[model samples]
Target chain A: MADEKIKSPKIQATEQMKQLITEYYIDAKTTKLPEGSHKPICWITSGGPVEFLIAADVIPIYPENHGAMCGAARIAPGLAEVAEKMGFSRDLCSYARADIGGALTESGAIPGGLPKPDFLLCCNNICGTVVKWYEELARIFDVPMFLFDTPFIHVEKPEHATEYVRQQCLELVKFLEERTGSGFSLERFAEVAMLSVEAVDLWKGVLATAESRPSPFTCFDAFIHMAPIVTLRGTQKVVDYYKLLKKEMEDRVAQGVGAVHDEKYRLIWDNIPIWYEMRNLGNLFAENRACLVADTYTTAWAVDIRIEDPLTSMADAYTKVYLNISIDIMLEQLVELMERYEADGLVMHSNRSCKPYSLGQYDLSRAVAERTGKPSLIIEADMTDSRVYSEAQTRERVEAFIESL
Target chain B: MPVAGVDIGSLTAKAVVLQGREVLSTSLTQTGHNSRVAGRRALDMALDRMGLDEGSLGFIVATGYGRTAADFAGERITEITCHARGANRTHPEARTVIDLGGQDSKAIAIDERGKVLDFVMNDKCSAGTGRFLEVMASALEVELDDLGSLSLESTSPASISSVCTVFAESEVVSRVAEGAPKVDIIAGIHQAIASRIYAMAARIPTNEALIITGGVARNIGVVRALEQKFDTRIVVPEMPQHMGALGAAIIAGEHHE
Candidate 1:
């Protein structure tokens, strides 16, 4: 297996990205609060308006990303079991279970477990689970929580909905000011929002490079590379990091270096990645000479944010993200992804953690296949929970899907 | 060239040897504790039946859940594709294949060339599979093979509403304790399994030439129940259990080319 990995080279960017994330996490954890100009830590949802936190000079931490780390480390089930033991339903979102468990047990992939949150930011743009999940956290930590209620976009985002979210953004800034004793800075906010947009555009450019025949990188690479973009979105480090990563991808494309050795087929992935099975899943496709060129999960960050009008644009962008929208729009997006990536098939992970992403995937699978004249495979598993995964069954389905293609 | 296909399923291992387009020999055996041993035993039995040795075989392909566990095969294909290929081989017009194995059930949609177009499988449930039938047979104190013919004798099929196998088993036991006829309860169990299978199969368009191929296909009651629910005449190939191995053999022959 070690030799196999050496033979199949991983993206050169992953090593650097890991160091960057490590440094970022260390800085967030070690930074002192209320002393020597230290920033407070704000536990934010994955799809929350983190730029506001960044603009307010508050260190933002994502429980979802931490849950994914625990998943990759194969400790999610232990954490989830902790939550289940506390009377939470096993059917509840695994990420929430893991997060709640990590908080309670004070055990996680990280050493100290997500730098004790000074406050909580709950956003429902990604899923409704976060609202309740964060409320529970607020109760446990006894901190002032800010909830950004982004209305679901069934078909279209109404102007009032945008105004509603925009006003909430303003309120969030005021909340941050009152809690941290730091006034909002428009100049710093604009700079952070611009950097965030630049990082997102760079991420988009990196993903688009996969449109080349024998894609330069796979979705697994994007899944890992997406870390800095998610956690440090509004920081200059994210922009610099993505610039360096984008250059590597461009070079690989120019050199005709595909992520898969032979690249016999190109496929698109749907829903959150099965975090525990990332390497196994990557190898499964790579072994079949089928490269997963793109996925709907990581591309959520690529939704171009308008820095000129950051408030309203952030509201619209976050509201219309891939998960918060209707099945019609989701299917359309899947169809477009298939065509754009020139995928031979689409592999949809019927993820158990993320219902907003997993629900309606079967219907979307058929719709995309009909549109692309290709095939689609739906594998049932949770994003973070490894116990729900049946390796033998999933292997059979994946191999069969590739064989059919 | 004599090519072989091996299907190492959860309960049984099957093998088929093909010389060109003609099936030279076939073998079936209990999978037992080790899939690798079962696979080797099945293949060796087929070879011995053909008055040949392993050296005579040109290529081999493995299918079923234990396909990866077997180290002997040159390639491993999925049972979904194998079933489709085997069904299409036996019945030239077969476009759909429903395979009911010990622990799982699947409905596969295939093209004219025997390539799988779409498929759906039961989600880690034994509610609508051969294992479910075996459990019901034991609960009714009936032989697995005889349960099907016995169910045909019932005039009124009892209602078994529980979709879960465990609950359905308890339902069957309770009905028996209540002095309900075994044949009616058996019929209901068959119908319950068929309903779940039909629901999963309905996910994709079940085009013409729907064929049922698996160990459970031998159970006439479940087959008839499924036929009744699908509202279509289902064809069961001769030696349905060997279809996956046969398909693997066919694929092996192609790979040898």
Candidate 2:
């Protein structure tokens, strides 16, 4: 009884892709890439395999980056519906669902505008979501899946992990050398390893822009800018990108321009953003002259900590990252950031989409402000799905709070 | 013959003293770690506003995530029931209630007589909630009150993807990295939140007589974004944030009869 003229092309394309994923395209590994100059397409995480991929000239794509794109485009909703249709619960994190679902519905259930991968690489730095996501993708596509297994860190990383992951790094190098026509770039990597480290120093500087009384930018920008590091870390380009970003921040600060109206306060924000409303949130903050000084992402970058030699030091550092460890360690890191940034207060976001990250936030919030003498505020909401946010009420409470401060 | 209501939420409690349909007084504060302390604090604050005591002649009701936690109250009602009653009283024609609280966002459909029909709630993520805005507000160094007004000035907006509050922190940091304008980021957050709210309301049959309640209703910026998306006038009580509490008291009064 509905008008057929109103049908959407986007929906039609999705239907076509679902059919293709269900049918024709066989895993190409059964037949090798046309034995030419073309390199094997590789899937990369924020950490793992970046140096090795570049050494072998393998084209790299970060799945997390794709996941973000799906969210920004509101593509997560449809993909999430597809995942739910496949029996995944609606309550599952939409980021995870959209990533998997987008892959299924994208240009026929493949990464749209992306080359078919010859190999897949992921690490144990971030969360279990990445591992499971890659596992399913590998199973569906039938490609070689290589996991850069980093040992779990609770209190502190054990000494054995250093040698273990380092040896794995070397193994990674050999794997790439055999697959590609290029030789093992040992000296190049030693150089690349150190180069990657310096980028961190620059990244930290760029992040420092948030310290401005009226921060020139916001946390969402950092999330966008982190893509190059995920995709091009070892390459000189990633380092160059950070340098340029740092320069812009310096310029913003020098002009005395407020990211918000008259940044009279500095606050630290906890948790991820609601992708559905990143732009609006930032503008609202700018009008108040409040700037975010530090956040948890400063640690996510530890995923790609450069190893001095594919044999030592670097892998150990990667394994020790705050994210690879326990909440207690994250707490320690939180204390460090709050103190280092000299922030007046803390804003804790109790996000429902990611239960793990937000689980202990209330306790942590209490501890940070009570134990450390910093003012703390806790707000609850969802990050991706728009169904969760209430702007007017939030505005009222926060305004009164700031004025009170 | 004005009636009053008090709503105590998980994080904060509110008291909106109503005289008939007009708001006489309203107050807000943290709920503390325990709900009892929070509930008492809220009640006392409302009493203080009215220059009266707990031994008043009117009715009393309690509502919110911590409705049952309000042990001293004469009556208890679900936030849904309280919201319906309050919204109906605010705009007699309101067919829908969109209430965004500190921890949850809800969309309710009501019949012409203020009877509840269908409702949806997003209690899962902090991304689309006030918590998300609070985080970004802290990061941007902006006063919370100025957030809604300043965000309207930004020409360009930033895209924030992390649905988890934890990861969104990383995203906001990255925004700072790229030199994206702070106001733009805040504005984007408001839009993101509004989109979530509108989508939920759309799921159930809705009409122009929409009412918004909860503590977040005070944010003008969120109201603007929601208005643009819903494409209809939004009816909010003078003390929109305390409608839940007010409804609770009204219910208690009726029940006492």
In order of the candidates, what TM-score does chain B achieve?
0.98, 0.90
**Residue range B3-31, candidate 2, lDDT tens digits:** 44567786688766555555666678798
Q: What TM-score fits each model?
A: 0.97, 0.58
lDDT for every model? Answer: 0.89, 0.67
Worst lDDT 10-window in candidate 2 chain B: B1-10
Across residues A211-245, which tens digit of lDDT does each residue of candidate 2 receive?
66566655656665665555666666567667776
Weakest 10 consecutive residues, lDDT, candidate 2 chain A?
A1-10
lDDT, candidate 1, A60-178, per-residue tens: 99999999999999999999999999999988999999999999988899996878898999989898889899999998889989999989888788899999988998898889999
Candidate 1: where are CA atoms >4 Å away? Answer: A1-7, A33-38
TM-score of candidate 2 versus the correct structure, residues matched by position:
0.58
Question: How close to the true structure is residue A183 of candidate 2, measured as C-alpha lDDT?
Answer: 83
- Candidate 1: deviation at residue A3, Å? 5.6
